[model samples]
Target: MPAIVGIAQVVSVGSSGVFHIGDVFTINPISTAKTFAGAGSFITGRGISVYNESSLTYTVDDEVMDQGINFNL
Candidate 1:
């Protein structure tokens, strides 16, 4: 099967409905995610009870991989 590409939207200002660089996201449950800025892109992050703000932190999820979403990089 060819790799599937996904896309997300910038939901809010303080917190992103879809996580991106310089965005904050707190995950309570196991949820799938993708990149917001670029379609079929990816980022790295962890499941945290409370997501602290970062300059360019990304939430690592498996909504669409091979784009750049990977942990322990």
Candidate 2:
């Protein structure tokens, strides 16, 4: 089962931590997590040093993980 949310809760990552949305912006390690907000839930993730999506011609401006990873669906 999955949960639903509205877009009204979509807030920017302002907290400081490894699992926080803001931390991923700078550290870019590579991982994946269950993204949620007033707009519901989403499986968010990003690539890492071992995996580069950019080189594959896939541009990911926003990533939920600090490294190369994906939230299992």
Report lDDT per candidate: 0.44, 0.40
Model 1 spans > 4 angstroms off: 1-5, 15-18, 21-73
lDDT for model 2 comes to: 0.40
Clashing pairs in 1: 45-60
Count of clashes, each model: 1, 11
Work out the TM-score per prediction. 0.15, 0.15
* Cα lDDT of model 2 by residue, 1-73, tens digit: 3445454554564343233332232454244454333321233567423433443333444856455434321
Highest TM-score model number: 2
Task: Count steric clashes of candidate 1.
Answer: 1
